[model samples]
Target: MPRFAANLSMLYNEHDFLDRFAAAARDGFKAVEYLFPYAWGAADIARRLADHGLQQVLFNAPPGNWDAGERGIACLPGREAEFRAGFSQALEYAQALGCPRIHVMAGLAPAGADRAMLQKTYESNLAWAADLAAKSGRDVLIEPINTRDIPGFFLNRQDDAHGVITRVGSTNLKVQMDLYHCQIVEGDVAMKIRKWLPTGQVGHIQIAGVPMRHEPDLGELNYAYLFDVIDEVSTQSGWTGWIGCEYRPSRAAQPGATSSGLGWLAQRLQ
Candidate 1:
């Protein structure tokens, strides 16, 4: 079976931060991803995961202004210093936690920025990140956030992600395709998956219900069937990477900070 992972950053509320691992453990998932974990400390999370037999499929270095709608800093100009400092620490954190994947935050576009310049900036940033990852023997993923839900963020499309990585031309760097974002931006999920899977550009995958970004079963993303497709791909090519569940609980809107109910997702994974 293709292993599935939860997005602990959003699921943190559903199980309370402390027990998110246990909730994911119960839900039948052995791996997961999160937006950031600097506040939680590396050792603490690693210990918790060890206790629960869980692994971090991916985790991002702290992105600037997540609350103000900023997702990452990979494309932000004049922020190269920030990206370097932040990612350096993230490498240490990932190494300590034994996480193989780290998502580089490609922050929002600068005010009145030139497209070509922004593209160059992104390419340079990925090269820098890839070098660090290579030395550490870890993989790094760059993500594209959907503009519909996350307005003002740059790097919102799979093509953009692929272009940046291709320019950098490093195996240590690849695209982190968030399905929820793709469904919103491109609308064709499975075909895109196949298109990028062969190039090895699609490094990581995240799933959520459309229209609401909730559980995979809640929206019309067809995750059950999608997983079937993923299974087929895995069989033909032996591609067994993590699929992160990054969604919110609609009814409980309580930030899922303390629900302890997230483990059900693990159980739901086939």
Candidate 2:
């Protein structure tokens, strides 16, 4: 069985942000990840994780003003200085939290902007980020989010992400493969995993049911089979990383309903 990390940003909504660590532990999760941790002090976040004995598997670097619609600043031309500063801040948190990976979100492409310019800035920014992270012995990840969920997101396809990673030519930079987004963007989920896992470019993975982004059991994808495939591939290729449970629970307030729906996850762990 693969180790699963609960995405606190999506799961355990019934609890407050800091309190979600305890909730995840009570619910049988040994690891957790989230969108961002900038709101709280690193010491507080670290204290909560230690209190719950949960590993902080992943968290994104600052995405600029999320409320103002800035998903990330890396790909935004002329924001190189800002992106570097944001990365340094994220690294501080990761080191203090003992977290090993940070997802560097590629900001949205400016409307009618020069495509070539955008890609160049993105590649340069990521290379710089990867170099900085490498010095700290941390890995930088790039996730290809589905455009439907966030229109104009700079990184939206697996191949495109691979191209950027290849161009960056840094071992510290790898793909954060999110199955939910892959299913929506390309649909050959298992094949893609197999293809990428061996390249050693995949640093982390996430899963959610397709079409609804709900519990994996109700999705079009067979997570059970996929998890088995992942184990087999890992054994053969030495790919060891957490498969983040980045899905929203069916009902946050209804304990019975959520627990019943999580049966599929329990079976896999068993």
lDDT of each: 0.78, 0.91
lDDT (Cα) of model 2: 0.91
Error of 1 at 73 (Å): 1.7
What is the model-wide C-alpha lDDT for candidate 1?
0.78
Q: Per-residue lDDT for 1-270 in model 2, tens only? A: 688998989887767899889988887889999999999999999999999999998999999889999999888888888899999999999999999999999989989999899999999999999999999999999999998999999898899999999999999899999999999999999999889998999999999998898899876999888998999999999998998988877765685444556788778867
TM-scores for all predictions = 0.91, 0.97
> For model 2, how big is the CA root-mean-square deviation?
1.2
For candidate 2, report its TM-score: 0.97
- Residue range 217-262, candidate 1, lDDT tens digits: 7776887777778777767765668888787866555554324444
Q: How does candidate 1 fare on TM-score?
A: 0.91
